[model samples]
Target: MPTNVSNLPPVRRWVPAPVTKEDIDWADLTFVDLAKAKTPEGRAEQVRLARDATHRQGFFYVINHGLDKAIVDRMIDIAALAFDDVSEEEKIRYRARIKETGEYLGYKLPQYWHIANGVKDRIEHYNFPRDVSRREHPNVLRPFLPEVQRIVEFTHRGVLNEVQKLLSLGLELPENTLPDLHPFDETNHSFWRFMLYNPRSQEEEDKTDNVWMKGHADHTSFTAIWSQPVTALQIKDWDGQWRYVRHVENALVVNCGDTTEYLSGGYYKSAVHRVIKPPSDQDGYRRLGLYYFHYMADDVRIAPLLDSPVVQREGVNKFIVGVPPVQETWRKNRASTYGVTQLERAEDGTEYEVVNGVRVTHYN
Candidate 1:
């Protein structure tokens, strides 16, 4: 941490630019109240709500998470400066080596990634791993690392831990061992992301039907996306229709990750979602996003807790034959993908691949 953080720029909270004026179709999502989740009686209420959320949509809104809005504002404020005030060359120095080493730490440049069918990908994001000291970041991020660390820890312990418990209780578990399975302070793939999606040209949009990202699922225990006012995010529903995920003020949109689906024995399969060009009304301005990508521990296996009554009730134990650690699975997928050499979908447009001896599926 910087000495006293005195040299850091004064906090100038970021004000949201005007939201889209377009009348867009939005999906109805269940909201899990964290304030209620903290209480004994309310915990059960949240468990049911969360179960309903994970079961169908694999997505939901998390509200009253007790993460002070001001702190969030500060984080975004600092992130804005980090992106806007620095040189691309300097930022690129810390870019993640996802292709080379299967690592997603530090900065990732816009348009650096390749997309299929001649579509140009546009994004610049920074990923700060759970262990902040694991890699160096841009100089501008140094002073705020302490507070950023606090925000990460708080989101894990205060916000995510509550939701994890709800999911755990929903499974009829005797104890909330989910915390032990996904510890906050451990060496995990969990990371905070500050991202920017720049506007695309009309010609580019025409080529891809305004699709900014292809269908994909995250390799995390759970993913927390700090809601931003841009109608670009959409999820593939059960009927295979694309539905927009609405933006809720002060709510973190949470989704079940692939790893969690494996752990739950398909009780809640990971949802597939993607980004598209901002609606015409919102396309004029760039979209800035804040997120906490929560991955399982390095050594957590991809298998259900058979002891759980729900898993047993689900059916005959037909999970991974020889389960592998999630870290290896994540590493294989990360290293293989990212425009180097397209790994043909295992079958019928799927991200099914055998990694670490487990059959993992994440559509891409």
Candidate 2:
């Protein structure tokens, strides 16, 4: 049974992933099994694997991280309930003040952003920053905050921290090198999000070519997406071709984000990903996503770790002076993502906006 069972609404039919299509070529992403890191040899091997995953694909799957299955199911169930049980009129009361404050700590309606040709995104989500209690939620999710918090805490400590350390070791830096910059005790934009991608009509789907979200990188550091069976998630491969991320029960599809590119001096590039409509076997089902976004401390400098042997050898690719702090970058990028301010598109056909000398990309 999931957590907060007594308070949960009647369980809805949980949709599972369909049989993976045989003709589709899935990305051969590296797998980092957390349970394998119990021994020194095991940890060393994981470090190599982590480096490979970061260096090339920039996205990988993590398994055996010890997050209980029931807890994950509870979070998923609560996501569906939070979005469906609340009325649109009432949901706005708790919406994030993105245009005003650039903080992503509440519900977001799908009708806010224009995807392409004025077709708004077909997704709704609730963001719970590390200090989730800062924002008010609807009654449907009020009782499940603690359960959701568990997901955030575990993802931060049990997952992100370990992965950070492993990557730092791969850089030949101290084990705590990267993790120290992202202290959970302090506040940052790191958030746990419950996302629901609503199904689109055939006309709308055809108009947009079935892309739910556009192909772009994340603005934060690391993102851990709890893998559901849905086959809509895809990542741009090394050859710049999009490939579906294979589904693994109870695994997390973790990826690097932009801030990490600056911190590691470009040793790790941010993963570019997008969501599209599911295959024929899984079409018309609402896609549920649980994500933990990790960001560095706001006061931390967004520069290369020169102490890293790999970085020193490779040289810093993004060591510009007068770089803005993490807060401004996070806020500006967050605020501009949906064009809270004026937005522009490049002649080259990519949606782009600049903030603090950074080019933020969006889908058309």
Best by TM-score: 2
Query: lDDT of all the models against the reference?
Result: 0.75, 0.81
Runs in model 1 with CA error above 4 Å?
1-9, 316-321, 326-332, 335-339, 345-354, 357-364
lDDT of 2 by residue, 1-364 (tens): 2344556545564655566565777999999988898789999999999988998888999988987677777678778887878988778888877777666778877877666666778788888879767677788888777777767888998999999999999899999998898888755668888898999988888778888887878878889999887788899998988999988888999999888887788889889898888888787778888988888877776878888999999888883446546555665456545544456878878777776777777654
Top candidate on lDDT is 2
| Local accuracy of candidate 1 as per-residue lDDT tens digits, 1-364 | 2234445568666667566667777777899998887778998889999987897889899998776665666678887866887787888787777777676677777776555557768888888877777778788788778787877877777778778888888888854667778787565668888898888887878776777877777767788888888788898876677889888877999988877787788887688888887776775777888888776677776677777788788853445566445665665465446444445566577655555555555444
- TM-score to native of every candidate shown: 0.90, 0.92
Error of 1 at 352 (Å): 5.8
> Which consecutive 10 residues in model 1 have the weakest lDDT in total?
1-10
lDDT of 1: 0.75
